[model samples]
Target: MAHIPIEAVPYLESAIYLPMLLIVLEKDYELIEHGQFKLKRPYVHLIEEAKKLAQRDLQDVKAYLKSHYLKVVQGERDELFTEYHFHYKQILEVRRYSNIRLRNRVEELLNLYLNKASQAHSAIQ
Candidate 1:
């Protein structure tokens, strides 16, 4: 796997992405619990689903960040990002009713990183 730069992740909060992330993570956990991880087709399909969801959620987050940062923070010159330290908080609390799947996290991160890198590269171009 290619390395992702630390700063590229943005100092964003987890709650922004946590709920959607949990969905993907839960699905992955189910697959593991059922012992279906050996099937390449199922594995691939789960990864695809996770990637699609992550992409959609990330887009929402990007839009929210743009609007919120501009309207509330930049326009008003608020220091919330500094005082509250938004990055450290759990953006969304995982309801433990469902188990978390490790594979889902890997796939989600992979897709998120790749998409971000592509966006950054295109922006530079």
Candidate 2:
């Protein structure tokens, strides 16, 4: 698993919600004809949960984006400090890692939802 920076967690979390939900629903269609759509699927509940999570994360995302812009004050003297801030690098790392995590979760959910024995029943007669 890759590491996502704390600052970018909410943005990544919110970003995953829709993609995950879409993958779930699309799998139902793609797998249904192949007799692998679950009869008692938790799609509704899963969507609700995703919605809640997205809502929470969206608030954080908005807050972060809104307040993240700030001007750093530099001292007249730069002889004492040589290190510089790496906030942009950290954010990039977080986005990269979060994307990996999202892709992994999508694959996992697809396998679990479409490969279940209980899901081997066809919706179409």
Candidate 3:
């Protein structure tokens, strides 16, 4: 398996959404490359769903660092990523959730990451 350092990961809040966001972006890229690109409706819906959460102050310098890392990786300022980048920065500034919840969500997101990976592999096979 490939390795990624903890410090390489963007804002802590991103651990919750970054994987999902990357999956969406990957799908978008695939569709475009296949010349089947539509409006990317599912990606749009995911963004909307993420935005439905109540506003909180999560912005911080650390979050900015992470988001900037992601922007550099993507090499473009797409709307979905840019918005999440902004949100993560906000979250870093002001925490809205408890530690216990944070740990649980991290676990949940790990499962999501694994599930998505498996499904993608199956699709390719």
TM-score of each: 0.32, 0.31, 0.30
TM-score for candidate 3, residues paired by index:
0.30
RMSD of every candidate to native, in Å, equals 15.2, 13.2, 14.7
lDDT of each: 0.45, 0.44, 0.43
Where does the lowest 10-residue lDDT sum fall in candidate 3? Answer: 49-58
- TM-score-best of 1 and 3: 1
lDDT of 2 by residue, 5-110 (tens): 4555445444444346455555654554456556634544444344444355446655664465411122232333322122332333312234455566766644
**Tens-place lDDT digits, model 1, residues 1-125:** 33323432342333334444656656665666577456666454455555555666666666655544411111111223211123212232112211134335545675674465456555666
The TM-score, computed over Cα atoms with residue i paired to residue i, of candidate 1 is 0.32
Off by over 4 Å in 1: 1-38, 70-84, 87-125
What candidate 2 gets wrong by more than 4 Å, as runs, is 1-42, 70-102, 105-125
Worst 10 residues of 1 by lDDT: 70-79
RMSD in Å for model 1 = 15.2
